[model samples]
Structures are given as C-alpha cells and as structure tokens.
Target: MSLLGPILLAATLAVPAAFLAACFVPRWRDEALAWQWLAPVPALLAAAAALVAGPFDLSAPALKLSLRLDLPAALLLAVSALLWIAVGAGVLRAPAAPLDRRVAVSWLLTLIGSLGVFVADDLLSFYLVYALVSIPAWGLFAFDPAPETQRAGRVYMAMALLGEAFLLAAFVLLAAGEPHGSLRIPDVVAALPVSPWRDAALALIVAGFGAKMGLVPLNGWMPLAYAATPIPAAAVLSGAGVKAGVIGLVRFLPLGIPLVGWGEALAALGFVTAFYGVLVGVTQPNPKAVLGYSSVSQMGVIAAALGMALAAGDAGAPALVAFYAANHVLVKGALFLAVGAFSARGVRPGLWSLLALALALSLAGLPLTGGFLAKAASKPLFGYGFAALLAAASSAGSALLMLHFSARLPEAWRYEATASPGPLVRFWPAAALGALVLPWLLFPFVGAVGDALSLAKLWDGLWPILLGGLLAYALASAADRLPRIPVGDTIVVGEAAFARMLRVGALFDRLDAAFSRWPAAALALLAIALALAWAAAP
Candidate 1:
C-alpha cells in the first residue's frame, strides 16, 4: 500500500468522528446515531492493508500527524475494527427506543479514540488518542440514570481522570528527558533507559496505564462499569477500549533493555491481579460482572508476559502480547454478545448453546482455538521458568471462570421464551470463528506458527484447560457450599470511601460558602496578593 493509503485510513477515523461532533446540531443529532457505524470502516481498511502489505508510515507538515502500522498494532486494529463495526450495527438495529444523543456522541468519541490509538505513530498522538478512548465512555453509564449506574460512572471517571493525570506527567517527563527533544515514541523510548527520570517515568506510565487495565486496587471501576453498561457498549468497552492500555504498554515500555527490578515488580503485580480477579469473579452472581473480572485477570496475564519480556530484553514480546490481546478482543466481544444471544428465546438449545459454550471455553485456551494459539505463541517469552508455571495457572483460572460463565447461560435465557435470537446470535458465530482462525493466519508473519501448533505445544495448552474444567465441574457440583460475595468485591469498601468523600465535600462546601461573603472574599484576595508580592521579593 502507498503512504496515501495509511494516511487515508487515519483520516477515515476523524471524518465520521467529526460528523458525530456535528450531531450536536439539532437537525443532525438523530441521524448521526444511524451513521455512526460507518466511522470504523477506514480503520478496518487500514488494518487490512497493513496486515497484507506490512508496516507503513505517513506524515504531514501542518499538524505533524504521523501513523505507523506494524504487526501488533495491525492485529489489534483489525479485530477492534471488527468489534466496533459489528456492535455499532447491533446497537442501531436493536428495537428503537428514546436514544440519548449524549450517549451516541460519547460512543463516537470513544470509537475515534479506540481506533486512533492503534495507528498513532507519535507520543503526542498516542496520548491524545488514549485520552479520547478513556474519557468519554463515561456517557454509557450516564444514560442509564440509575443510582448504581451513577456510582459506576463516578468511579469510572475518577479512575480515567487519574490515569490521564499520570500519563500527562509521564509524557512531560519523557519529553524533558529526550536529548534531541523529539516527541516521537521511538525517540523517547530510546532515551528512556539512560534518562535521569527513567524510574519516575516508568512509575507514572505503569500507574496511568495500569488503571485502564484494571490492575488490583485500580480495578474497582471495571466490574461496576461493565455490570451497568448496555450490552453493546460493554462489548466494545471490554473488547476494544481497554486495548488502549495494552497498546500503551507495547509502545511506551522499553522492551529491548533489561530492567530487572522494575520488571520483576510488575510481573509480581500482574500475577497477583490475575489470581485476584478470578477469586472475586467466582463470588459474583452477575454474568456481566464475572466477565469484567475475567478481563481484569486476562489483561494481568498479558502484563505479566510483557514484564517477563522486558526483564529478558525480548523485542519479540510485543508481537506475542498483541496476538494474545487480539484473541481477547474477539473472544470477549463475542462472549458479551453471547450474553444477549443467550437471553434470546425460541432458539434451539443444542447447536447454539454448544457453540456459545465452545466460544466461551476458547478463552481458557481450549485446543485448536485462537486462544490456544495465542497461549502457545507467548510460551517463548515465559521460557522454562516459574513465570511459565504462573502463566499456565492463570490459564487454568481463566478456564474455571469461563466454565462458570457458560453454566449461567440458561438462567439468562429463561426470561424471554418468545423473543427471537436477534442479530447477536447471527453475528456472534462469525466473530467467534474469526477470533479462532485469524490468529493462526497472522502467526506466521509475526511468530512461529509451526512451533505454536506442535504436538507438545498442543499438550501444553490442553492440560491446563482440562485441569480447569475438572475444577469447574467440582465447583459446580458443590456450588451451594461456595461463599457468596457481592459483585465487585472491594467496591463495597469503595462505597465507604465515597461516603467519606461526601463528608469532605460538605466541609469544603461550607468553607466556600463562608469565603463567598463579600468581606471574606476581599480579605482572601488581599492575603493572596500580599503573599505573592512577598514571595516575589526574594
């Protein structure tokens, strides 16, 4: 493909996005929702070309916008485009109700950010795209208008704003450290190893991106958000939106150089989160909440792989992580859609349910699935060590969680016996099949597909899944004995914190009210001016 091709692809995202903004006009607002599905087409084209033609870059003078498409990014961009297009269509086709324009606008903005992040070539563009992806999706929760939805939105916004704050600080520190003052990602990352603020920069990057990935204490927003969001919104948010953080880790973290202490620290954290998500997930009754925790767990495993790669100075790790994330993008999106499908009645039980179960198990690395290929491909990074064992255990945990998800399918479907299977069932099989097959085709270009498919590799993928299945069966048989816990375990604790915040806000409000009196305001202004003048004297 020519440079113009990639440029065109990048431009495609903004045009539809721009139209979405224009929707604020009364005349256009309603029509924009119907048109929103087209926004991802350019991204889909760019990703397809990038995969076929190899990587490409484009630049312009006026705005200095740059785009580079490589294997990892292409893999993510392709699948993300697929999910956004499919889900956007599903949303539009669903029974028309009173649609919130604000929700539609937020969706478009999130789509732009989600697509743009995958192709962004420079640090500034990446940051801008990342912000777009994170900040606006709050509207999904906003439109539901329930107390729980409001609370979820509040937590989601808090974490997003916090992440952005950290990213800004990290970006500034990175730019300051660059010897040539270049703001490109490659330039800043090249400078990262020797920079004076390398540790600080890394800290800020991890904290910022970690929040988005839902690592541990930062994870409270995810379950709440996913549980409250509409199905279509949850589909893309879990599948495509969180990939912003994955891409961030790929682009920002210096993988070519060994940073042993930091790498090990990150690895440990990832391991903790992987196990933590499962423990909490199993306790929840809501299937959506379970899937949200599954994402948290799965992303943690990816983080652990990246951490290991960084420690060993493995440049190939990013491609491996991307392949893993790509499988997740499809499988998770399909599973979320499955939630809708399973809720449909009059669907024949045997084939559709079996297919749904198979797709759900794919996340556990069931044999021959894309998840299996992804797991096998990533094995080289874990090598033969404790990390490899941890990886296997995490896969087992995934299997357990997914089995639980499958078992709950019947309960979800029982409510609507007369309802047709809808587009969710019609589109889900394609997405699931795509997730299972596409990685194999891409594996040769990015990694050793033959190695990934080896008999021993197959066994490596198989045993953990078997173990997880057995464990899940045992848990199911003994279900009543398992401890009951609330959805989003620690979120209850967060509610207490929020209550404290209300008290603090009340105090601040009273303070503001007192200061607002004319005499107090004038006195405060005089005090501030006097303090400034005194400080200037030095």
Candidate 2:
C-alpha cells in the first residue's frame, strides 16, 4: 500500500504532464487534443487510492514529497475529478473534435493544477501547481477577437498575477518563520501561531486564497470571464478551479487553535462579501453573470464557515468546510453544463429545465438535496450566535439568487431553439445527476443523513428558502427598477488604477529619456560618486 501510494500520486501528476508535453509534437497534437478528457483519470484513481490508503508520503527526502488524502481533501478531490471527467466527456462527444491546440493545452495544464492542488503537501509544490491552475487559463479565452472576450481575458490574467504575488510573498514569510526550514503545509501551520511574521503571513494567505474564491474587490473578473468563455470551460473552472482557494484556507490557516481577533475579522469580511455578492447578483440579467455573483456569495459562505471554525478553535471544522465545498464543486460545475444543455433544447419543456431548477435550488439548501446535508453537517460549527444567524440569513440570500437563476434560464431559452440538445445532453445530464446524488452518498462521511431529515431540521432548512421565494415574488414587478451594474462592478476602479499606473510609466519614460543626455547622466554619476567620497572622507 505504501509503495503504491506515492506511485499513484506521482502518476496522477505525471500523466497530465506527459500528455501536455505530447501536445507539442505535430503528429500527436490532433490525437492529444481529441483525448483531453483522459487527463483526469489518473487523478481520479489517485484520489480513490488515497481514500482507501489514507495519508501517503513519498520517501524521497531530497524532493520533500509528502501527500496526504485525509477525508477533507479526499472529498474535494473525488468531486473535482468527477467534474473534470464529465466536462471532458462533453468535449469528446462533439461530432467534430472541439479543441484547438491552444485550448487543449490550456485545458490539460489547468486540469493538472486543479487536481494537483488537492494532494499538494509542500509550499513550493502547492505554489507551482497553484500557478499552473491559474496562469494558463488565460489561453482558454485569450485569442478570441470579441472585445468582451479580450477584456475578460486581460482582467482575469491581471487578477491571477496579483493573487500569485500575494500568495508567493506569504509562502516566503512562512518558510522564513520555520526554524527547521520545512516547507510542508502542516509544519508551516504548526509554527504559524508563534512565528514572528504570523500576522503578516496569515493576512496574505487569506487575501491570496480569497482572491481565487472570488471574494469582493478581487471578484470583479469572474462574471466577465465566465460570460466570455465557452460553457464547458466555465464548468470545470467554476466547479474545480475555484476550490483551490477553499483548500488553501483549509490547509493554510491555523484553525485548530483559535485566534479570536483574526477569526472575527475573517468572519466579518466573509459576511460582508456574502451579502454583497447576492445583492449585486440580483440585478444581473444574464444567467451566467448571476452565477458569477452567486459564486462570490457561495464562496463567502465557505469563508464565513472557516472563520467561525477558527474562532471556536475547532479542529474538526476543516472536514465540515470541505464537505460543504465539495458539494458546491459538483453542483456549480453541473449547473454550468446545464446551461449548455438547456440552450440545446431551447423552447422545449423537458427534464433538463426541471433538473436544472432542482439543482439551482439545491444550492440554496433546499431540503433533501446534497446542499441540505452539507449545511446541516456544518451547523454545529456555527453554534448559537449572530454568526449562526448570519449563516442562516445567507441561505435566504442563496435562495433569492438561485430563484433568480431558476426563473431567468427557462425564460432565455423559451424561444431560442436552434441547436439540437441531444448530442451533449447525454454528457451534461450525467454531471447534473451526479451533483444531486453524490452529496447523499457523501453524507455519512461528514455526519448522519438522518439528522438532516428530522422534522425540525427540515424546517430549519425550509424557512429561509420560503422567505427568499416570497421576497423574490414580491420584487418581481420592481425587478426592472433595480440598477443594472456592469458584470465586473469594482473592475472599473481597478481599470482606472491600472490606467494611472500606465500614465506613471509614461512619466518615467520621459524622465529616462532626459536622464540619457550626456550632461544629465554625467551629473547623476558625479553626484553619486561625490556622496560616496564624502561619506568615506568622514
């Protein structure tokens, strides 16, 4: 088992890399492109092995390879792998091969990083995989000629670079704090609380991962990016790619030992983002954009959960948070594919819309859905406090936003039928079905399914949804009165800031030109030499 564990871990990463390298060979490029979906198979196998084998470490002391698949990571890995496979199947099912070389390579690289993140044990490995998952995604949409596509690509890539900067700085501080020079996550986390750079590291860690999760200010890129990308790419990116942040929090933060101030601060920021996403989402007319805001909202809920757990000093919280996030990975991923499926059979009232509706509402914690199981399992961690009330209220907001999704999708597709939904329907529905059913299967791993179904518990899940539904109905007439915000709301500010930086660059350029004149350059060098000479003389 020990021997097989590291081999499986290595294979999971090696397979994608091998295929990605194969893409560069001209003769193999087409075939490699066609089989893009096959890349996640080894990861699926590795996740399964880890599920059975428990934590595994590679014996190479020099490489410092250590990987563990505890229940939290295993849960996320399984669903992420499943999302990749389902999306991949959708690609392969197309009559003509759907991938160009650029897209195919980008997809494979993103998949490798997405899956690698779950099992990454050390700081350097995590950072490299994290960058892999992040930076290459630009190629997915970068070449498109449309202005929004180009703009989305630019914004996304910029935000990704900014996030990488924050996380890299945090990792350096973390390594510095560790006297033993170990880069393993567990070791770094153990040293974080007492380390000299503890606050700085933790702050950067939260902001870094929070950017990936679509937390406010860092979030403006998602809506534009998703709306611009093709649906299948969006599916895996939303479902699998974003969870990298959640896992970062789960792995990086010192959750077991509570720091009340930091915890409360995180919880406060989370709640603000939670409400912010939904309120902004409600005004969005595009279903895809709505889902983007919803991601922001949903991720905020996850952040809030982590924050509360940290406040309580609960060691068991990471598992519960993982369980919640794992369900989202499936549900959100499936929802993206469902959008594609619905557009296929536009104007037809079939099982797809109904299924999509159920799935959308599931995100709002509809009773008996996987979301309910997730919410209930994590309920104890929130305890009886204002944070708990905020958690409950967030469900109302989820219900409201999802109801907006439920209503908007069918309306858009009611008259736009042209594409035959049948070709991809087979593949997409499998994802939707899996999302609905998998949480039930995973329930026992977190807590009992029966507890989620008790009369009181069912009501606990029911009221918020009812309130949101009623509010949604009440506001139906006033919907148009709501302001129409752009997809990336705060992005306008970011863009302006970037513009100012460019203007500053121009100013520097003019100064550099002046400095290149012989007299100017001679004076600068003479001043520097004189200062040095004077200091030495003194």
Candidate 3:
C-alpha cells in the first residue's frame, strides 16, 4: 500500500491525540477546544483513503503501535468520522458565550479513544483506546446540576469500570492462551477457539462488550447517560461512542467458528433486549430518554445479528454488522441533534415535529432509508426460520418504539419553544439530511443495490414497518394508560452507584484528615498492607 494510506491512518490517530495534548497546555487550551471540530478531519481523510483504496496496515516498531483498517473498520470509521465532524460543528456553534473548558477537554479525550478503537490492531492499544472510549465521558455528564445526571454518571462509570475489568481479564487470558506471545488482535483471536482458556475469554468478551452495547439488565445507564449530556455531546456519544461495543464484538468474536451454544444464548439475550427496550421505551415520557431505549433496542438487534452470524459461521458478519451500525451512527446522531434543536426559538415545533417524525422512523427501517438497507443486507444471515421471524419482528418493534419517540418529542419541547433561537439550530437540518442520504452511498459496500430494491426484498423491508405503524396507531390512544416507567427504568443501582461515589469521596476526606498525622498514617498504611498480605496468603 502507498504511504498515503498509512500516513492517513496514523494521522487519524495522531491528530486527536496531539490535539488533546495541546488542550492540556494552558496557552493553547481554548483554541484547542474551539478547534476540536477540526480534530476529525484526519480521520475523515483516512476514511476516504480506506473507502477509495481499500484496507491499510501501519506499524510503529518503537512505539509498538499497530493499526489496521479493513472494510469493516473503514466503514465504521468513515461514518463515525462523519458524525464527529458534523456534531463537532454544532458544538462549536453552540453559543456566543465562552464554552466550558471541562466540556472541551472531555470531548477531545473521548474523541481520541473513539477514533482510535476502530483501527487499533493490537490488544494493548485496543484496551487503552477502549478505556478512553468508555471512561472520561463522565466529565460530560458528571457536572450536571440535576441529580439524575450525577446518578447516571455514577452508574455509567461503574459499568464502564466493570466492563474494563472484564475486558482486561479476557485480554490477559487471550494473551496467555496464545503461546506465541503475539498481542495482535487477529493473532490472539486466532488462538481463541482452541485455547485452553477459550470459554473464559469468550464469556468475558461477551459480557464486557454487552455492557457497553446497553444489553438488558446492564442497559439502564444509557438513558440516564444520554439524557444527561448536552445535545452535541449526546449526539456523538449515541451515534459514535456506543459503537465501540459493536466494534469490540466485531474484533473479538471469531465469526465462522460455529460456537453454536454460546451463539444461541447471546442471540436469545439480544432478542429479549430488543423487545424489552421497546416495551419500556414507550412508557418513557422524555424524548431523549426514549431515544436512549431505542438505542437499547437497536443495539440489541446489532448484537443479535452478530450472534446469528456467529452461529452460522459467517465470515462476512463483521462487514454486514458494521454497515448496520454505521447506519445507526448517522441516523441516531441526526435524530439526537434534531431533538436538541427542536426546542430552539422560531423553530415551529409542529413543523419540526413532522420533520422529526420522518427522521425518527428511519430507525424502524422505513423504506428507502439507510436503516432498510442495513436490515436487508443482513436478513439472510438469520435465514428463514424462527430467528428470521424475530429479526422481522424487531423491525416492527423498532417502528413501534420510534413512533413512541415521535409521540413524545412534543412533550420535550412543551415549554421550551419560542420565536427566536440561536445558530446551533441551523445545523440540525443538515445533520438530519446527512443521516438520511449518507447510507445509500455506503450501502453498495455491504450488499448489491438491486437486491435492496427488488420487489420481494422491498416487501420484506416494507411490511414490518406497515405492521409497526398499524401497531403504533393502535396504541396511540392508549398511551395514557401505558404505565410510565421512569427514564432509567428499574435503575435501582444509580443510588448504589451514587453511594459508592460518596464513600469514595468520604475516603478522600479521611485521607486528607489523616495526612496531617503522618506517624499515624504510616502505621495505618502498614497495617492495611499487612491485612492485604494476610488475605492473599495460602
């Protein structure tokens, strides 16, 4: 491959890292923040290279950096890069008032990790970038005045750390299982199926990635987290950050290995999450939070596809799955931007509502939309049976949930609309338009256009939406009767998460108090160390 490919790939990573580093320096900080919108340019450029020229590999011996971009990584990176740039614009144009430094730094840190994960080729680099992608986003939500935001931050951090721990163990097991000392992802995964610790590695892999993807039982954090952030932050996180989990599954799971038992179990879980998110989402009153549940449901569909791909031993699963997720990146980002902009003054909530309705239903795989191509491309993987039927139902379920989202949009703007709004509102239309048309350009990468347009295929994509629309209409009147589940439904742990944060804060307090008593602190440290040693002793 040409140096342009490798340079573009390296630049994609280096630009974000360099920019983030610059933000830490006092002199360049605000400028760096303002310029954060420009941060994704290299990534966009790299994606352009990947799209036009195919996959590229880059290695730095001294830095032990190995980055690889194939079709899957390229596709996700391209769409995700597009999202970051688009949303970053909205962030820059947010208001004339000085932007918050914390938000700026947080955005850059998150962007560094977010862009890095797609092309990261080795275990160590992946873990580091994955951590960047998962953590540090707390800054975006942690400082919110609302208790729900703080509570959500607590839960989100807990989940993120928990996922990190599981993934670390999995990576360690994977590395240990590979006798050759190779840390490259492909090499480690190549050793997985026959590794002595195969089951342990796979289990951790699934659980870790599952948490990030917002799979059920672990899904409560998403609504709280997404709803907590400002519009631009929420847009990027939903559209791009969440896809880290999708990429994680793509990277780690060895498709075409016929691990049927595990595959089936994950598929079943995915389907359950799919229905559960929709059921719960409809009850939610907040548009952002409802979209959060839509995320839960949509993510589950992606997971189910991965599961089905695993069961069928389909090597092509990663590309198809990435295509599905890429579509989501654009659509979800655009929708969240729309939600943010709808409340702006002078924007007719009613007219915007109509526009928003069309944008939101794209999640349901509306005909001629990006989501439809995503569904159609991957339909055959599930095949003609119970699995396929569930897949079809998921489209309808998505429709039903999105209709609920549309229904709830007005409620979000109930008291916020007006006749004069800021410049941020202007970007929404462009973002929404991009979400709508961008997928068609990328669709040819995943599947044939003729097949996507075929009468039977169109019908396959069409009926579920019709059924869902009917179902939505049927339920519209009864929405009042639908038991409204609080956003972050069943979030029993937010308090627990908050409690833990409090304890940690208290510990810091005690540490500060004890620091003045140096002798006592030393004794206490020695005692604590001995206690830890005693606990580990055989």
Q: Output the number of the lDDT-best candidate.
A: 3
Local lDDT at 245 for model 1 = 91
Q: Model 2 Cα displacement at 335 (Å)?
A: 0.8
For residues 1-538, what per-residue lDDT tens digits would candidate 1 score against the true structure?
6765767566756776676777767676667777777778888888878888878877764797777888889889988988998888866533234555677778888988998888888778888889999999998666666787887888789889999999999999999999997888889999999999999999999999999999887887888888877777888999999999999999999999999888888888888999999888877767788899999998899888888988888888888899889989999998877776666542367987787777877887888888888887777888788999999999999999988888876666543222323666567767667777777776776677677778998898889989998889888888887887666566678788889999999999999898777596788899999999999995
Give all TM-scores, in the order shown.
Answer: 0.89, 0.90, 0.89
Which ten-residue region of model 3 has the weakest summed lDDT? Answer: 415-424
Q: Provide the overall lDDT of each model, using Cα atoms, as 2-decimal numbers.
A: 0.83, 0.84, 0.84
Where is model 1 poorest over a 10-residue stretch in terms of lDDT? Answer: 412-421
Which stretches of candidate 2 lie above 4 Å from their native place? 93-99, 411-422, 496-538
Clash count for candidate 1 is 0
Give the better candidate number (1 or 3) by lDDT. Answer: 3
